[model samples]
Target: MNAYGSYVEFDRARWAALRSRTPLRLSEEELQRIKGLNDKISLQEVEEIYIPLTRLINLKVRAAQYLDEVTSAFLGCEPVHKPFIIGVAGSVAVGKSTVARLLQTLLSRWEHHPTVDLVTTDGFLYPTRVLEEKGLMARKGFPESYDTKKLLDFLTRVRAGERQVEAPVYSHVTYDVLPDRSEIVDSPDILIVEGVNVLQVSKGQPVFVSDFFDFSVYIDAEEQEIRNWYIDRFLLLHRTAFRDPSSYFHRYAELTEREAVERATNIWETINLLNLNENILPTRGRADLVLSKGPDHQIHRVFLKDL
Candidate 1:
């Protein structure tokens, strides 16, 4: 492995070699279904990158299980089962969601962990009304826009193996949290938590969100690449989702192509970029593993923390 600061860096080819003949478990259709709007992932990429990643995670899970059993036996107590939580964090358009979803799907297919669940921090974002009241509408994706206490409590209960724990649901179409709805998370064998702020450290909080993660990943790319992806995604949405009358961004559907580009660029610069620099990017070093992407959205390199 190539050494890179505190991490062991692996280029795409090297990282792919770690698959160790693991069979490709995902189909192209499935990959297409899970990829983000502007993200590019192929079955080849899955076989090379994600398959090996999941294999590594599987080994970790097995070790954790064995440790739990050994500790229980040593203490003359019954073994307690707890979900292995994985946190995936990144910037607005860095494709962390795609990675998280892929992990949930692949990890569940493994015989040892048949139950894998996925959750996004988007659900924990404050509602539009609350943000408006707090004067944080423009800062929606920033750390302050989240209900950290609620999120922490949710993770605490999940970690304790609480049954039927509920998390708030978020609607992308409305760009707000649904007050009347929630996601019930039954204790699964593995839980993948994905979001922009999952790795963030709260200054005054006694416990941070990352404390609940057994493993964490940061999806990385140059700032300019992410900015382009965000703009491209906005343009795609302008032609599609934003055209829906019920969409919160429907107003953008009326704009010309140039106007849409300008507006999207402005939002990216003024809000998402600031959030990335001030809150998100700083947490990159905190991740257990980091997947760095190329401009084409393919993960070109991986930086994994040494065990």
Candidate 2:
């Protein structure tokens, strides 16, 4: 295998060849629903790439279960059914959300793990008022913008196999944490956590967000490509979602197309790019798997850590 730190590298062709007898379970309509705004993922990509990836994850799940059982038996305790948690981390506009959702759907379809739940770290971000008070209004996606203690506490509870744990809900339209709304995490067989900062280290905290992850994936792509996609998505939102009076970005929607694009580019260059370089990209090597993508937003290579 090709080398990448302690990982094995596989080109798209080689990675595709790993698929074996995994059924093509999703339809075009379902894919359309799963895809993020302006993101492209064909069914063939799922068959050739994600099918094998999910198969591998299932294997890991079974292995984890066996280890848990053995450990419990050795300690003279009953087996505790702690759910397997998978963390998906990436730069903004890299399609980590889509990957996380797809994996949740695919893994849930398997008999071995039928109760997959997906949660995004967006829900952990501080409220707009809090951010404004903290003077982090423009750094919304950065690690400091999140309520790290609450997020870590939630994950700790999940790791202890706690049930009925509720997560705060964040709205993209309003760009703030929803008031009095939460997503309950029942006893799921598997949980997928997706966000830009999932893999990042929380300074001065002993328990990191990634500490609860049984497996993790980091999506990789060229900075320029990601920037272009981010701008495109921003423009699309400006024309549609941002046009709503209730949208946080309604002011941007009023700008001319050229002005809107310029604003998006400036945000990317100043905030997103800086975060990607300093924080997100630095965590790539720590992931269990890295899905490297081309300018087309399609995964072209995979790097799996040596197991």
Over the stretch 6-99, how does candidate 1's per-residue lDDT look in tens digits? 8989999999999998888888888899998978898889988899999999999999889989999999998877899999999998898889
Give, for candidate 1, the lowest lDDT window spanning 10 residues: 1-10
Residues 146-232 of candidate 2 have per-residue lDDT tens digits of: 998898889888878899999999999899999989999987999999999899986677778898999999999999999999999
The TM-score measured for candidate 1 stands at 0.98
Model 2 weakest 10-residue run by lDDT: 1-10
Cα lDDT over the full model 2: 0.92
The local lDDT score (0 to 100) that residue 86 gets in candidate 1 is 97
- Regions more than 4 Å wrong, model 1: 1-4
Prediction RMSDs, each to the true structure: 1.4, 1.3
In angstroms, how far off is 286's CA in candidate 2? Answer: 0.4
lDDT of each: 0.92, 0.92
